[model samples]
Target: MPRYSSRQELVQEMRKRARLFIGEFEEIAEQDKDTLLADVDRSPAQMIAYQLGWMKLIQQWERDEQAGLTVVTPHPDYKWNQLGPLYQSFYETYQDWTLVALMAEFEQQVAHMIDLTLSFSEEEFQQSGSRKWAGSTPANWPVWKWIHINTVAPFKSFRTKIRKWKKIKNGLERIL
Candidate 1:
């Protein structure tokens, strides 16, 4: 896990990584967007759907906690151990969506996250226990960590996955 010294740093990193992640999609052809890679089960559009789904879930958790409701990490019906099913649900939720529509929704969610991040105070961003729903296992993470894991970190990782998917589709040499 990475730590941020300030909210600006977190916001900047989130923007940079998200831009890099979303930029990968521009290089992909519309027809290839739905093609599944042999090594990965998800199509490129489905991958973006998964990321968007998680972002929405995090927002819901934050909203629920702010309203003084019990926050369920991941989801209410699903536990940490049930992530596979949860991911399947994400895929199913966006299965009918076109790539263009998914891209528009992804951009909207990222903008929403950026706005949400900007609204946090320095203390709320850095101090642990700022959000009770964040949980205490493995130490209580500050709000920034929650934002990083759900946004920046996953964007960096999923960017790599999409790049690898592109290479595999083109029968090019693997970069790694």
Candidate 2:
């Protein structure tokens, strides 16, 4: 029998996948601990490593929403300048069953997501698609963060093609 189909089942599945992904991260991280991974191998590790971190963040956010938690929208400010040292640390702890400091840092961010669920009202969600999305789970459709996208999308229309303004469209408007 299939183990899961409902929401709870799905969350459990995601957690399980996260665990497995961690295992893979350790496998790769161990291999490179003593040396820099070639460009071929290193970049993917970086990407998956980063995404694994983000998955934890997104899931914690989802759990809060499921429980009707409330807060404001969140800006993406988790990572900025620190990466090289973190990667070096990962290389230092390769192949261990235990977590490297980078993983610990990621786990800490996940915990913060729990604390900072970006709580918002339904109205706020309508105003910003991402406010609603911040609470969504990966089990659902992959979230497309539209927080950066304005509520009104700017797309050129047929009118743009047809309209020709007579020259004096002055920057300063006439007072009538």
Of the candidates shown, which would achieve the greatest lDDT relative to the real structure? Answer: 1
Each candidate structure's TM-score, on Cα atoms with residue i matched to residue i, is 0.91, 0.33
List the global CA lDDT of all models.
0.85, 0.35
* Candidate 2 backbone collisions, by pair: 30-94, 30-95, 70-119, 71-119
lDDT per residue for candidate 2 within 1-176, as digits (tens), equals 13222333333443444344444434333333323222223432343344433444355455666677752223133232454554444443333333364455545543343233234333443332444444433322223232111110100111121111101111112422
Q: How well is each residue in 32-57 modelled by candidate 1, as lDDT tens digits?
A: 77788688777898889888988898
What are the RMSD figures for all models against the true structure? 3.0, 19.8
Write down the worst ten-residue block by lDDT for model 1. Answer: 167-176
